[model samples]
Target: MSAALKIGFENPVAQSQAVFRAVMMALARPGTVRRLDVPVDAVPALDPAAAAVALALCDYETPVWLDPALAADLQVQEFLRFHTGAPVTEARALASFAFVPLGGEVPALDDFAQGSLDYPDRSTTLVVAVEALAEGEGWRLTGPGVAGEGRFIARPLPADMLDRLQRNHALFPRGVDLVLTCGDRFAAIPRSTQVDA
Candidate 1:
């Protein structure tokens, strides 16, 4: 007798490609936005959006970090290892990638990377999975990629962090990159874009 095998419609590699395309489109559009439904559960830290971000950016070259609340969860860690093939790293030393599952308050942005005057690219790229995104309520954005000016609220960022980013912009082309992941949607705010207080 022959046995039947089970197969499902979800393919991570395909999802990864779609994610890449979406991210590219977002970059091309700049302030524009897009959403993706990733394969994952609705949980404390690891949500569908978070999973989608991993699918798009995380790979062997990337390094990941989870908040203490969700860091040691075997399922989360193993899934990250299995899919992204990335290793976990310390918060102080930046890896190619970083995930802030803060789940509450975002840390001081400078704690991450603001880049150096010489090699601004040396700064870290941050992936923050947050609750939501809205306009005219968060921080004010100006400079490249933006029209005249834009405003958005992100909780309440630390004063020092704003200062660091200001310094990063002084370097112009050299500075840290940002990707804000909310739900299944994401926005990349490259260092080239200036955030004004």
Candidate 2:
């Protein structure tokens, strides 16, 4: 928890570990959205796991973008600034990392990164903190990491997100990566995962 702030009654170290576990499970399961535990020990707009992510990932070298709706909260922003020394930027142009709060309109999937043909790894990532996460009637996912093809839905995702992600896969190693977080749970779906609607 290097230089991370103590949000509230919750332990920052414990929260960070929980997030790590959630992301690991999500990458393994693909389309399945898992639930994270949110202890009522923090302030509004700052979920325990979300705060943990700021602690774990953000640093001077990593630029982060949170939804503007949350920008008004100097407490949250200052906490991030003091703890991570992360640069904040606009949604569409955010480079490496993003933290999207709930209630605002979700951005177009392409707003982040889809990588590139030669350097697919250069794409940006969005750390969307959703209201809740659960399995839904989403497009079936079947690819390198999946055991078999299956239908998986997560929201609130963009209307054209699936299509854009498909196109992103055409670039392969160059497409953007994602981290979907809710409560204390999160999952990372790298560009390598193939999505078919």
lDDT of candidates 1 onward, in order: 0.62, 0.67
TM-score of every prediction relative to native: 0.75, 0.77
Q: Count the backbone clashes (under 3 Å) in each candidate.
A: 4, 8
Instruction: Kindly report which residue stretches of model 2 are placed more than 4 angstroms away from their true locations once superposed.
Output: 1-18, 35-43, 91-94, 113-118
Query: Please, what are the lDDT tens digits per residue for candidate 1 over residues 1-197?
Result: 11221111167678778877887665554445568744543344564655677756887876665655556666666667766678787663476666676464455555665556676666667666656666555567787666788765442334475676667566567556666677667676667767777
lDDT leader: 2
Tens digits of per-residue lDDT, candidate 2, 1-197, equal 33444444256577666655766677677766666654534446866666666776677887777777777777777777776788877645556777777666656666775556676666677677766555556677777667777566667776787887787666677766667676666656667788887
Model 1, stretches more than 4 Å misplaced? Answer: 1-9, 28-31, 37-44, 102-105, 113-118, 136-138, 156-164
Give the Cα RMSD of candidate 1.
5.2
Instruction: Name the lDDT of candidate 1.
Output: 0.62
Residue 176's lDDT within candidate 2 is: 69
Candidate 1, residue 148: CA error in Å? 2.9
